[model samples]
Target: MLRAGEPGATGYREALEALCRAYWLPLYAYLRRRGCNCHQAEDYTQGFFARLFERQALVRADPTRGKFRSFLLAALKNFVADERDYAQASKRGGGARALPLDFGEAEARYALAPSDTLSPEEFFDRSWALAALQQAMAKLKAEYAEAGKEHLFERFKGSLQVDANVASYRDMAADVGMSAGAARVAVHRLRRRFRDLVRQEIAQTVSEPAEVDEEVNYLFAVLTASV
Candidate 1:
């Protein structure tokens, strides 16, 4: 049986860890793009995760009100507002409040350069969408691995992407030693599973179930805008 956000065996600690792993990059990127120096961004990002874990916020998350990304951003905004002064006042022995985060490297990887065409808000939205997709993919891969169909999953995983230019069903069937009809069915099932996994991933972040569609629409808009 799959144990996601269920009450029993939910293991709040484990779930929080997973959520941090999944969202830390997006949060970090958001902070960096907002003009925080690398060190401050890292500190803020780490502190955000620490606070989230300390508060057991995930236990009370309800996917019925809004998208998880919205909730997280709002929380992050509030955290920064509340902690800015305190964080700025505190300093290391060197007398620098900044924690010496490698913002340059982070910038190269996650931050958008001024020359980039996308606005900060657009960048954050796209980053959020990609992060959500990655989380969904990770869960799907784990499910396939657990079901002993890892090979099948790898064979068709590329087809899930919008711009994959995936192989024809006949070619996929030949590669997998399955009939063309089976290959078609397999791809359909794969898409269905991916959608379910993506929905579940988004669901875990929000406060209400109704927010899933809204989030999905926003994500798609981000993707579309990028292209």
Candidate 2:
């Protein structure tokens, strides 16, 4: 992402936009949990990214700060503190460029967040975890589609996380026209594949391959904590 921070770099703008698109929801949810209403939170989130990229604040990232996610949250908190008037700020004011963020969907998603007194940071962590899990699942589904097994994947995927004793292999077998034993095997393989994809997804966010496991554990911990 350092390229994204470079002035006048080719594709830097697109790279930064992609990054914002991926993480904006979590940031928006974080702001909401801090008591910003939907419109206020949307404005803050849009302004935050606009100012963040325009000022090239990404150049301030340091390995010592650890995960990029944590660094982002810290930067956002600093931005909000300094830009207290964001609630009234317009996209054109302060030369802030408008991004095409979908705040309507963002608010819809935020409405499903845990209501059990989670701190803003915890909510951000949970949102990040959910986003990563979603990306992994999307990738897994695409691979199944490529192999012409999308139907099978769909029928067996529910068992990937369900306890073997709780999941009905018989029902899945009937749905997929497979024997119960084959349905069990399909779920086993799909679960293994899904785990690998999740690890791969985590690998993208960390500084090193060694950090993937630690990040994975942290995200899963956040998920369980939310539950």
lDDT of 2 by residue, 1-227 (tens): 34444447788677667656777789999999999888778777777787676754556654234676777788788777767675346533333545887777998888777688889999999999988888789889999999999998887777777766524888888888988888888888999999999887666566567878889889889999887
Estimate the TM-score of every prediction.
0.73, 0.83
lDDT of 1 by residue, 1-227 (tens): 12333434558657656665676666777776777777667777666666665554444443234555665676677777757553452331123322234445556767343346776567667778887898789888999999999998999887886433245777888998998889888888999999999998877766567767878898898888777
Stretch of 10 with least lDDT, candidate 1? 89-98
Most accurate candidate by TM-score:
2
TM-score between model 2 and native: 0.83
What is each predicted model's overall lDDT from 0 to 1?
0.68, 0.77
Model 2 residue 71 distance off true place after TM-score fit, in angstroms? 1.3
What residue runs in model 1 are displaced by over 4 Å at the alpha carbon? 1-17, 53-65, 85-115, 162-167
Worst 10 residues of 2 by lDDT: 87-96
Q: What RMSD does model 1 have?
A: 5.6
